[model samples]
Target: MGGDRDEGDSRMSNLTGLSDDLINAMNRHDLDGALRCYTEGAVYVSPVGVGEGRDEIASFLGAFLTAFPDVRWTPWSRVVVCGNVLITQWVITGTHHGPFSMPNGEIIEATGRCVNVRGCSLRTMDGDRIAVHCVFYDQLELYAQLGAELVLPRP
Candidate 1:
């Protein structure tokens, strides 16, 4: 039992390290470095949609960062690890300083809108590598604050 507990703690430490590395890579826009934190067959599911495998994940983030060059994530809480699962909470603060594409093929530039967003992620780890990551956030509030229409449903 003691050995198992030690192993779990070690795993948690590794996951925390990986999470920090990922955030650092994002801050530096080092997509390759970020990709190194995930397993080769890892999956990333963001608030927008799902991306399977490292290549797809990289491409998605690359385009996203290209559109939002100033995009940044600030972790407001420590990663909580349990067994093979890891949870992290963060606040993403960024300005619209570049082109952002709408779903209907509209491209808007530099709305100059600043966004303060609260979000969370769930990650499944295989050894020290992240195997699956899922992120959740409020897209409606983000869009509305960015000057988009408020399409919220009435209670």
Candidate 2:
């Protein structure tokens, strides 16, 4: 009853704290610190691709940090948790100062464009660590902000 509710509340607090820590690490471009928030065998997925395990996850995130050296993630008003899952909406602001690789094996050289993109993530926690993290954002929004023109192939 009362005891169970207390435990549940404490668990929610811890999850929220973890989410904050992750965002802080990303804001600082602290790759190691960010990796520490996930389990050893964690899986991360985004529009770019999927990464399994710490090494793969590191590579995926490291690229973004490199491309956007001054990237910052600020929570966009809401962070909700239901059981072991945490959902967060965020805004990423940064300048393109390095190569950004595309999912289709193409690289976009630094356009020197300042980008402000809104995104969200869903994290499933296994104990204190994130076991699975999936991020959602519109690629078109990001690319348009970067001044990229979309070219359609003739079909």
Give the Å shift of residue 19 in candidate 2: 0.5
The residue pairs in collision within model 2 are none
Task: Evaluate residue 97 in candidate 2 and report its C-alpha lDDT on the 0 to 100 scale.
Answer: 95
Candidate 1, clashing residue pairs?
none
Per-residue lDDT of 9 in model 1: 83
Q: Give the poorly placed runs of model 1, Cα more than 4 Å off.
A: 79-81, 101-109, 150-155
RMSD of each: 3.0, 1.1
lDDT of 1 by residue, 1-155 (tens): 99998987887788888899998999888999989989999999986567899999997788668766878988877665567787889987788777765555566667888887788888899887889999887877777767876454899
lDDT of 2 by residue, 104-124 (tens): 767889999999999899999
Error of 2 at 45 (Å): 0.1
